[model samples]
Target: MLQTLDIEHRLKSTLDEFVADWGLDAEITAETWLVEDLGFDSIDVIQFIVAVETAFDKRNVGFQELIMQDGRYVDDLSVGQMATFLEARLPAA
Candidate 1:
């Protein structure tokens, strides 16, 4: 089974590649905000969520529940939070 730490590491790596490929001008960390800190608008956020789903090789994973509120992303949504969310969704192996 993949440990929690392993999942987090993979999540971080995936996010790193996402940021690089998109040419985002912000540092990605556990506490980095996707919309505010990373400069991701609504469309970018959707694209990023798709990229993360692909990166983790998981489908139908919903991140909007975690990041969205009142039709907008919550300001405090962080990379670490997303990692934690993914860790729960990904099957252990």
Candidate 2:
């Protein structure tokens, strides 16, 4: 039974690994913006969503949609936001 904080930690670690695997030179933190700060394009955003899903063992979570508005990717997607999203999906401990 993983707690929310535990899940969040795992998510952060997963994001770190994901970015490293992509060869992006950016500091990952709860406040780091996925696009502006990390330089993620649309394709990168899609792949990021996939990474989140895979890390959390979820499928079709539509993570990209959360950070989009009017069919455009939002410039802000912090690591904290991703953790919160995954936290909501986690079962109560």
Backbone clashes per model, in order?
0, 0
lDDT of each: 0.75, 0.75
lDDT of 2 by residue, 1-93 (tens): 456578768877877887786677776777788888878888877887888778778797667567777998677777878777767665554
Pairs of residues clashing in candidate 1? none
Task: Put down candidate 1 lDDT per residue, 1-93, tens digits, no spaces.
Answer: 456678667767877887786666676677787777877777777777888788778878777778777897676567778878877777876
Model 1 scores a C-alpha lDDT of 0.75
Q: What is the TM-score of each candidate against the true structure?
A: 0.75, 0.75
Worst 10 residues of 2 by lDDT: 84-93
